[model samples]
Target: MRRCNQCIVERMDSPVPLIPQLAAHLVAAGGKRLRPLLTLAAAKLCGYPGTAEGGTRHVALAACVEFIHTATLLHDDVVDESQLRRGLASANAVFGNKASVLVGDFLFARAFQLMTADGSLRVLEILSRASATIAEGEVLQMATQNDLGTSVERYLEVIHGKTAALFEAACRVGAVVAERPQLEEDALAAYGTNLGMAFQLVDDALDYAADQAELGKTVGDDFREGKITLPVLTAYAAGKEEERLFWRRVIEENRQDENDLEQALDLIGSTGAIAATLDQASAYADRAARALAVFPDSPLRRLLADVASYTVSRGR
Candidate 1:
């Protein structure tokens, strides 16, 4: 992880002014770095420590994973028009949207540079496909914005592309580097895909109910942005006709009054939307845990399973 962090910092440095600074503004703020961690752990599980003894491929790949993730975050904040990220001014907010987007593009280019250096066409294919899918996911989300009629299946499709695709690639690449069998690679990808789903669902639930301190961003940012998430969908689906109208007003028409957030919260809470969303997240979390069953019962496998279980707790 330390090596991956250092690699991220080093690779992000550039002679071009403003790029590194803008990238640092977001990266330095710090995030869980969970995607890169998954790469390392998956490699270890497949019998690669990514250290001096085994090999150093995992470290660079992990950094590449992180770079891909950070690039997405930079783009996401601009698309969402988010002011805060990790409880600090977002890159788009601190710099400008144009700078943030360009810096994000630079990071993506750096990621591909790392991939090309690795000389693995397979790894290149996985990461490149994930990057493209992420863009499609973001565009799909935009298409669904303020769409109260968006189904849960459609929501899952968006998250699978935007959030889960990188995770799946991160883990699958681990096996690829380790020369693990195809089944193991498939299992690791499944673990990542389900885990990513759980993580995003919990995040959606948290957006409606968590403290700004814990959430690291505004609690009602999703609501204010008219982003269609499962919680709002659950509430809107179960709401009375008048309540549905309220969803249409705030979510579809983007006509949120000062008290509307509170009202939305009440409806979400009263309709058990948060709990329902958490339960759905729990289901995915369990799937993530089950996906690791193919792996031998080692500490890494156990730890990864624990991570799947932990995603459920994060929502609570």
Candidate 2:
């Protein structure tokens, strides 16, 4: 998956040379490739008929998913004004926002080109819908920023659209390419969705609880950005009167101070928000593993299950 990503970025040509450089920056700063791995695992578990011809299509389609994901990261960094991604300077921070946005558009076009080459209308449709959903989720999150009333339910909905939709679509495309039965397709899709949700839950917990260096970004970043996540939601729900007032000032009044961050962290710790969020993440991981029970046992299936477990176990 990583090599395919590198190759695509290397093959890219842009009228603006900076765009290719931005694309290379985005691609080279590696992530787990969890989405593509899910695609491959789904294909294997579905008993894809072994054929040399199918392998190429599978790989191309997987690369297409990663491209779409990378494009989103480029745009997200621009929107979030993020300085760091994958422990390196974000494309927007390094190459400037215009270059990042334009390069992201190039990646989107390249992903479409790859999809067309695969000749799977189903794959195309799933990815297109997922893209739309992801956009809507971003807008929803933007709308809700710093709003103390943002419920846990709403937060879950946002992550489902912003994060899990792509994961689900990736698995769905894998099944489509493999010509899997409907039941198997549904199972893989469910597994991906649950896994993605768990991944995000852990991320939210880490935003408040992790060391700055270990997280590859500043701690309390979400709070500073006024993006309320799971731990904050839990703390808000369970906080004392004074703690609620603290939230009102930091989140509502935009009064973030060092003391405010410490207070928020204290509230999160005292209220058991971090532990609660971890429990939720573990539940989602369990659901993800359970979704694969219908498939015949194999190393690929076991690896998929392990990946789900690892999502929650990851050190931020």
Candidate 3:
């Protein structure tokens, strides 16, 4: 993690001083760095041999993944008009939206630079496509937001593009760098994709279920934004006519009052939406664990499986 941090600092250096400064501020704000960790772990699992110079290309690539993820966060905060991230004021909130957006672009360019430095078209292709897919997902989400007519399949597609695509790329790149067998590479990709899905599912559920402190931002942030997550979809599906009217007014029409969020919570709870969401998350987590079955028993495998389990457990 420290190596990744230093890599970010080194890469952020630019003639435009504010570019680096703004990028550095959010990078310094702590996160679990789970995506990079997965990259490193996948490389290790594949028994990647360092180059003659005693260098692990995986570390640089892992740092690149972090840069991409952080870049998304910076842009996401601006788009969401989010005030807090990782329990601290968001980059857009503290540094202004313009600066945050520019720095985010800078970080994205830096990520591509790292990908090119690695000198693998495969790595470049995966990361580049993931970046594009993430943007598409964001746009798709905006299109679907507050539209109660959104189907479960469409919601899954959004999460797969926005969240799981990067995870799949991150893990797949590790296997590519290590020149792992195709079966093992596919397994790791499956593991990452499922894990990412579980992680996002829990995150969506937490927006309604968790307190502000535990949630890292305000509770009901999604409700306030009129974002339609799975729990909202589930409850809306199960609602009676009066309850459906309430949802249409609040979510579709965006006619929320002060008491609307409380009422939303009550409806969600009554419909068992939180539990249902978590159950879906758990199913994904299990699939992630099963994806590891291709690998032999090892500490890395155990740790990765535990991470999958921890994804849903965090919601609880």
Candidate 4:
């Protein structure tokens, strides 16, 4: 963890003062550090010798993964026009979009530098592919926005690319650095992918169910942005003709009135879309746990399993 922090600090030290400040602010809005933890835990679970210096490469790689993720968040806030993130004002909201975007680019370049310093072509390949996939996912989601025809299949593809790909790469890269067997590396990669998918599904569910304070953003944000997520998609699919018409008007026609929020919530509830979304998330969680069955049992493995369990139980 200290190594990861050092790497972050080193990357943040920049000739451009504004870049460092913005990067610091974004980094201070800390998350679960689940990506780095996944890397460290994967190394341990793969039976890497527990020497004081054994996992330094994994730690560095983990930090690199987090840097890439945080950089994307800064840019995403700008693109999404989001005000709040992690319970505080987003970098773009505070520093303006231009600064945010440039700083995000700085971080991306720094992450690349870190990866190159590691000198592992495998790590570079995984991260480069994940970055491309994330960009593609963002574009796909943009294309599908406000379109009621955004099917479950399309939604899954978007989330897998946008959210799960990085998580998958993190775990796989850790295994690669630890010199794990090919089969074990594949299993960990699958575990990360499914876990990431489940994690995003739960986030979509909470967007409807959680309070503004708890969610750290406005409820119905996706809907207000004309973005159709799982709950709305499922509800729209199962709703009555009049209910479908309501969704079409709000989502497709972009005709939301003040009363539309309650109407949308009621319709989603009526169609049990939230429950169905929960079921889907739960299934992905189960699949993530199943992916770990090939690995030998250890504390790290147990923690990974617990993380899978917590994905469904988390508030946001």
The C-alpha TM-scores of every prediction are 0.98, 0.95, 0.97, 0.96
Worst 10 residues of 4 by lDDT: 47-56
How accurate locally, in lDDT, is each candidate?
0.91, 0.83, 0.90, 0.86
Q: What lDDT is obtained when candidate 1 is compared to the true structure?
A: 0.91
Q: Write the per-residue lDDT of candidate 4 for residues 36-148, one digit (tens) a residue.
A: 87887787788665448565787778888888888888888888899988888889899999999988888888889989999989889999899889889888989999999
Q: Encode model 3's per-residue lDDT on 38-114: one tens digit a residue.
A: 99888888888644446568989998999899899889999999998988888888889999888888889889999
Local error of candidate 4 at residue 131 (angstroms): 0.7
Q: Could you tell me how far off, in angstroms, the CA of residue 55 lies in candidate 3 after the best superposition?
A: 3.4
- In candidate 1 the C-alpha lDDT for residue 142 amounts to 92
Q: Model 1: per-residue lDDT, tens digit, 14-130?
A: 999798788677677899989999999999999975477859898999999988898898889998899989999888888989998898899899999999999999999999999
Worst 10 residues of 1 by lDDT: 48-57
Summarize candidate 2's per-residue lDDT along 7-78 as a digit string, tens digits: 465557677778767766755776778777677667767766444544666667777788788888888888
Best by TM-score: 1
TM-score of 4: 0.96
What are the C-alpha RMSDs, in order, of all predicted structures?
A: 1.0, 1.8, 1.4, 1.4
Pitting candidate 2 against candidate 3, the one with the higher TM-score is: 3
**Where does candidate 2 clash, by residue pair?**
none
